[model samples]
Target: MKLQDHSASLSEVNQSVDTTVVHKSGWRKILAFFGPAYLVSVGYMDPGNWATDLAGGSKYGYTLLWVLLMSNLMALLLQSLSARLGIVRGRDLAQANRETYPAPVNFVLYILAEIAIAATDLAEVLGMAIGIQLLTGLPLMWGVGLTVLDTFLLLLLQRYGIRKMEAFIITLVAIVGISFFVELVLARPPMGEVVTGFIPSLPDDTALYIAIGIIGATVMPHNLYLHSALVQTRKIKKTNEGIRHALKINFLDTTIALNLAFFVNAAILILAATVFYKAGHTEIADLHEAHRMLEPLLGTRLAPILFAVALIAAGQSSTVTGTLAGQIVMEGYLRLRINPWLRRLITRLVAIIPALIVIWVSGEEKIGQLLVFSQVLLSLQLGFAVIPLIHFVSDKHTMGAFAIKPIVKAGAWLISTVLVYLNIRMVWSEASEFISGNNPWWIDGLIILVGLAFISLLVITIIYPWLSRYRMERSARMHPTKVTLGSLEAPSYKRIAMALDFSQNDEKIIANALAQGRPDTEYILIHIVESASARYFGKEADDFETRKDQEQLDTYLALLAGRNINAKGVLGYRHRAKEIVRIVKAHDADLLVLGGHGHKGIKDWIYGETVNYVRHYVHIPVLVVQ
Candidate 1:
């Protein structure tokens, strides 16, 4: 088998894509569609939601419960639409946006989406750190610093497959759910009053502001990008029936997952209402204060303990999904893929640095404000994501028969309008407060300029689809004949290089390398000596491993010589991929043959991904044999 580069969405986990949902029926089939939504659902109840829900319930005493319900309903509809785009169109929100819009537009969209993810991650880092501080009595700064370690935890879980990662998230969700369930039991909130809280009434401006915050924070912008891509992980049939079945099952999955998220959010609000508002602690907003007051008001130590545990669970789960969203947006919009660890580390650090700076400069009292600011950042991007999603799923050319009906489209539009309006109101309120407190004229002017630019982008995004449709129709009528191109023949190899491990695969590598060469073509046998001394001394190292590698290369060259082949031996020290690439370039070889060790998952981490490094760095045709 020959290896080649594949630019699949979430290419690191491409092995899991389209491999789990094949040839199953009933519950087994339904289970395959269950995971993606769970991943998306975690975003709905992330640390960002905690601040808003806690604030609403404490300040308004369950009067804003209706907002959570309304937000949940909107999330279900929007998320289902997102999944339909993936199952029917095989494109994520980011990928669809890239294809639909111009390059500059997509670049801005990509940056906005990335900023939204970083903001979401900032909330998670703060929440997780606070939870650790609450539970272990550790300093908040240490807790914030320690949150960086979970990036490796994410890397480790990913090795097992998507199902394993899903299981881990589900476990965390359960912890949050069960923790709140116990808290509600302890608080014993009045059932009649709690039900009355959902009657859709805002008593004052404070209530309205909190209501806007609840709605704005509930529908995460990144989750829209994430759900559309995640549903493509399963392989379904190509027929209408297959698409329909996949859509139906995925809707069920989305409903269940998001409703569970609703329960978590509602429970947080209810717990806050019952414990804080009932005791006249209406100003409670900070998570640390909430946890501290829980023990005293609920009259049980367990209440505070469960609260801390649930917060940690929520933070951890949200961080995983946030990193995935970052990856999807970066790859989908930019077509750039990097090392997964490096990507995760970059995201975590982006969030972590801000968090640590806040902790060090302003202290833990400011974390709640930071969390709210992150939600505001998300609010700024919500319209940019939701409007495009609606346009894509409603487009007949892209969705075909899977295009949403007129009524569904109307409802999606109405929901998008309401969400965008409320988020704008919230963002404006936050911005006004900041501007009022600020001192510099340039800073205010910059904010105004950015706001105007944002509106311009939003306008262009809304109208571009119709404009693009018209342009296509006009072009098709004017130019009936389609453009065509001719294919070229394969090139002949003049010089080939075989990178050897001096193992059982050397002979196989030689055979494949020889097969690609012409009769008069020259070949170079290459190997790298990576011993302890060789790493320090380069080619001057005199070590047993170096001598052994040299002898192995000589034996391979002699074997090729006996076959009347034009071959020479070349050996280098230090890094495997770097040495192979350098030696191949120095010898002026046009082709490089490498043996695939079939390393994957943890083995890939241990042995290093040399083939990728060599292929990416060298400007030649690479043939990887397995």
Candidate 2:
């Protein structure tokens, strides 16, 4: 198959051609592969991580810094694998899952991925609002409301292209890194104790809970999906040598970006350990409380200001990635595309409504707890994404020589097993606590019911890949003979309808329609007048532009007459696609031919998507002439 026949990863912004044409070596070549991991890395040190790192640091006094280190390493490996899958197989994690699993299974997986994204966005909404409130003294509710406007900001950025968007994300990341670097300087954390904190130890169940949250916040599930799709944004050569080169360069990108993210996260925990724990205030879990204490404890007003600025930067950057992941999951699993703004609005609403209610019911004090819980919820969804990714990249038939080695496959499974065990343990601990408390009996029953459902889904995710592989192997053995195709029938059209915009494409559309028609076929020439007067008056309007449109249709009719073709002209006003569809049905045409304008991105917005609307609503075989 030709390359263009294959489906594009992100059709709107798929600019691999640009990268393919620009042949650069050395550092310039490496720079082309750098932006994707930076976008993926923002999810690591988002506002969600701030809540978990702060809780871990203030309560256990840096005992859980080891969790941060471990999670970062895992993230590095998994993200590299994700990039390899996209580069080798030309499929994202979600698309790979869709191709491998049954329809019902893919639907469930898509929902889970979306839930993880919403959970991530929930933390971002709260974190950004809190930061806004801290820095500008705006009400938290007002700040939450203002975040809805960010949808437009994202839309504006998208118009500029992905590289520009990546540049914007990198700038935010720089703001966050620089802010934390200054804060670590001001707090002056003890180097000796900080080094010892790297030794692994979980103090209690609470520490375990925070540690799980830390893992979830650091090694995000959505980032896996995002990274796979993001890597495809570059146009690399399809040869094995080219794939190997891309993989090597991408590993360097992932390592550098994630380590910077690690620094931002570790700095948060270390600063919290020094400023909050060493001062005898161990329960400084709330971000608001932490910010309030920063000035007096560190004896510098600049400390809290920098804290708020970094918080805002992290939230904004992470939210952009979260929405982008949502887009990838929906398109990959369902093969459906909607307006980007609509998707953003739906995701923001899902996160915002819950946040608004939580604040309204329990007040802002619960924001820290909510953020931590969201991260843990994200952790719970990790296995669904990670398992499928491992299965795809490890498949020898699919990945060929690019398949992961046995040792690497074993390492991936080990990580998966550790994540699964931790998640189970955390659920059990939380369930035990809830049941032992004075909570209602139904609440306990509900918890058990949800736990059973979650286990069933996870088990299906784990075993489906192996089961699928076994079934394929068995079928191959049964059908040993090579299959051959039979001849097919050709279709002939009796009545053909051609829609014209009175542009140069009208000739191409008419010629294609003639090629599909029989000698006795009748032709219906259609056009829609989009002038203002015709829109109001419809068929009765005798305006100058409408008359010229009618004249154009007559001109086409005269041309068809020279060939002794059965032809008639029909003109309608108002909505273009709607009128064309109506006229085509009225004429009972077997095939409809329309010209393609090739509009995309912001142009699709400006010039309404007429071709898409007509093709979808019309039942006839529609031919698009380019």
Q: Pick the candidate with the highest lDDT.
A: 2
- Relative to the true structure, how large is the alpha-carbon lDDT of every model? 0.85, 0.88
Tens digits of per-residue lDDT for model 2, 182-214:
999898888999998899998888898899999
Question: Which portions of model 1 show Cα errors greater than 4 Å?
Answer: 1-7, 14-23, 427-444, 470-490
TM-score of 1: 0.93
Question: CA shift at 267, candidate 2, in angstroms?
Answer: 1.9
Number of backbone collisions per candidate = 0, 0
- Write down the TM-score for model 2: 0.87
| Model 2 alpha-carbon miss at residue 534, Å | 3.3
Pairs clashing in candidate 1?
Answer: none
**lDDT tens digits by residue: candidate 1, 223-313:** 9989987887787778899899889988999999999999999999999999999999897779999999999898899999999999999
Question: Candidate 2 at residue 565, lDDT?
Answer: 94
Which 10-residue window of candidate 1 scores lowest in summed lDDT? 470-479
